[model samples]
Target: MRGYKQPTVSVIGASGYSGAELTKILARHPSVKLDKLYAFSQAGKKTTDLYPWLAVDMTYEAYDGEFDSDICFLTLPHGEALKLVPDLRNAGKMVIDLSGDFRLKNAEEHLRFYGREKPDDACMTYAMPELFHEEIRNATAVSNPGCYATSIILGLAPLILKPQDSAKVNTVCCSGISGISGAGKTAKTELSFSEMNDNIRAYKVARHQHTPEILQTLGTSATEPSFGFTFTPMIAPLTRGIYTILNIALDKHLPVSEITELYRSFYISAPFVRVREMPPEILHVAHTNFCDIHVAESGKDGSVVVITAIDNLVKGAAGQAVQNMNIMLGYDEALGLT
Candidate 1:
């Protein structure tokens, strides 16, 4: 740490799940100094008081104007970030937004899922580093993908034959129950220990907000011509990690061995993506940024199954945001991530 030029960084909405993860990673990041932590309501309190687990001690301030840093990570809610990101970028700050605000290419797509009018500004490049590393590297603003979107997109990327229409690809995604942390630190009766204990219930069937975000990413990718999928999200009795069971309808069947090899070959250059011989478990990637993937044959006609596991707040949100920041700043892609 002696001769390195540390970049100054800040986290807005620093009281949430993803924000806490970002704070933890940046505090120990070799080339970055977390200069500020901002929370609108918890203005004068200590970050540790809110998280009670972060080793880095910092005071949370209410956002007044711009951050005095080279980069800013916005972990605010879906509609909240659109109001602030434009100003941040205009102030010469690189922004990485962890909201669904700017993920879709068109404003109408955002409205359909989130039921809010999308910002009328220029598009922010979607920054799933494994799929769009080069674009992330050059963009001043990047929209980080959602947790479920990350799992589904990475799981199906390899088999995409050509750019298909949005209605062409037949996709079905079933995600395991997520931890209470993903719901944030707020107190809610339904998220209580007794209610969530030993229970698994599916919520947001087909109407999940992340649905369009996934479609937008897969629809725009060169290899996948189009995408159409039903996403079912369930809540499991856990504190972290997401396991997604993805079933896709294909035109023809590819051997399991060949499918596995294809996935392995496609992700060979991706450091955080591991192609596994067996299915992945959430515990293996529980607190890390890695996305473990497995491919197999399914009984459904003309369909293949892909299983992917990742820590919802890490690879899906905070960790991926930092990864994008590293790329934008010309640092080693894995510098602070590994």
Candidate 2:
């Protein structure tokens, strides 16, 4: 690898929260060159203009029909990346989309959940690194997981991925409280300072878009999940992080230590997932790529509760995207992440 050159990378929609975070991470990456930053609205402005703390000297430009980089990170809003991904892939540039555009494999479910029609060729490898690492490594296009989906999937993966006959999961009821940052940089009356200062409310109860995403990852379609799953997503006053609590009912009772050991052994090779002895807090993983999970028995009726914490913008969005990029580029998975 002596004569190897670092790959050039570009970011589309670089003015948003997740986009800016991705830009900062790519700027510091050792194996990739940060080339272009595209933010159509903020085009012609310097990167430091929006983020005064960044030391990089680059201007945001509007994306033309051309892409000069080997890799492209599309951090556009929900329906935007659907328009750009085809062109980027046709140009032979590796694409990583941070939107929900290509996350669902079933087109019917996509339209039902996202309320948008996607093309038939919208099948991109789902990039949940802990579960789909090998698929992502060989993928030309990857769809990053959603914030709530990331926290919940990682919390439940150990239990459902490889289930014991005696301990099959019957029901999974979980609630996720996320920071306001998960709403992105869009201005909304409901998300205003006075409205959300000391208020917390649940939105998209059973109709959350990420519900299908979580179910899809656990090896079942949304309409026909192997186990019962219910998710409630709430927005809190904090600026970052997602805290998820899952109440699971199993066919047989498993000890708290047994469940804890199952999680630890499952994620043993996963560097970013930590199995904690005590429950993790939102602050513990606010800005880091790590997903801290803790499990405990709830009742004698074969029930248990699993708790997980992660930064909504990091492990849930930008940081996980970078992890996929590293695997795709054949670099160390923890290269820029650590």
Candidate 3:
């Protein structure tokens, strides 16, 4: 008991959207100790100095040496993450990744989408604590789902993962705009305020990369040999949080009440998800880690619609990573996460 070392956590690429959020959250997380926070730009600077709002009563220190932590959080971009994950594992640090690097199972899939090599043999548990909780609990490395995938998957996993009737399904999702904060501290012409303010437009029609990640995770055992989808994203005039509306196509009809009952019963064990009576408002879930969901149907058509919303950066990324860590550590599954 006297020799115990606090489990240390590090944030690599801590200057970006998801990275910064994770840094702030982990800085205050109770069970885990904040070991090192790294940023290429603000490498030598202090955390409070870079993001004054962090106000955590800490100074920004340089990543002057190798970091040793029970777990390391990667907020790096997809391409960069592949390189970092393998080394981190070799160094014997368990990992929790917030990027898309390790989510896809096939290496070629990673290459096809991001033009990057798959991290070879760097096995990681897909970190969607609800469906893959067991895998995560024993896994050495963890891959967090993409932001959009988190909202969409949670909205539909109960039906798709273990389809009650094994009927086929389809899905659609929409996300709100966040401040350039979501884009990170980096500079991008497309994400500039002038272009994003007071505007709403769907960018990637069917080419959003997250589409395949979503389909891969949620559409696992469907019988259809080929699938078709319509996915579109818009830039809402907000700073953070993504409001997503997803519709799931079911081949068989289930009563709206039964559907609600099923969802309520299905997610009863999931802490961060809430099944609401009326469709949930984004604001209710906006600064929190909750995913508020509502279900509906036209009755005649064998289709069901699920509307879900969340703070894209939270439940969609950092918060989910923490949830996976809680599972992996066998701590209170909700400890320090809620």
Query: What is candidate 3's lDDT per residue for 194-292, written digit by digit as tens?
Result: 987777667666566676677777644122313445566666667677667766556667777887887888898888889988988768886577888
TM-score of each: 0.92, 0.97, 0.90
- Please state every model's RMSD to the true fold in angstroms: 3.5, 1.4, 2.9
Best by TM-score: 2
Off by over 4 Å in 2: 1-4
Residues 1-338 of candidate 2 have per-residue lDDT tens digits of: 12238888999999999988898899999888899999988999998888898778899998987898888999998999988989899988899999999999888999999999998678799999999989987888999999999999999998899757658888999999999999999999999999999899999999899999999999887899888888899999999999999999988888898889999999998999999988999989988999999995657798999999999999999999999998887888898988
Compare the candidates by lDDT and give the number of the best one: 2
lDDT of 1 by residue, 211-254 (tens): 77776776552123255566788888888888898887776555
Worst 10 residues of 2 by lDDT: 1-10
For all candidates in order, the CA lDDT equals 0.81, 0.91, 0.71
Question: With candidate 2 superimposed using the best TM-score fit, by how many Å does residue 45's alpha carbon deviate from the native?
Answer: 1.5
Pairs of colliding residues, candidate 2 = none
Model 3 pairs whose backbones collide: 46-60, 47-60, 177-236, 178-239, 179-239
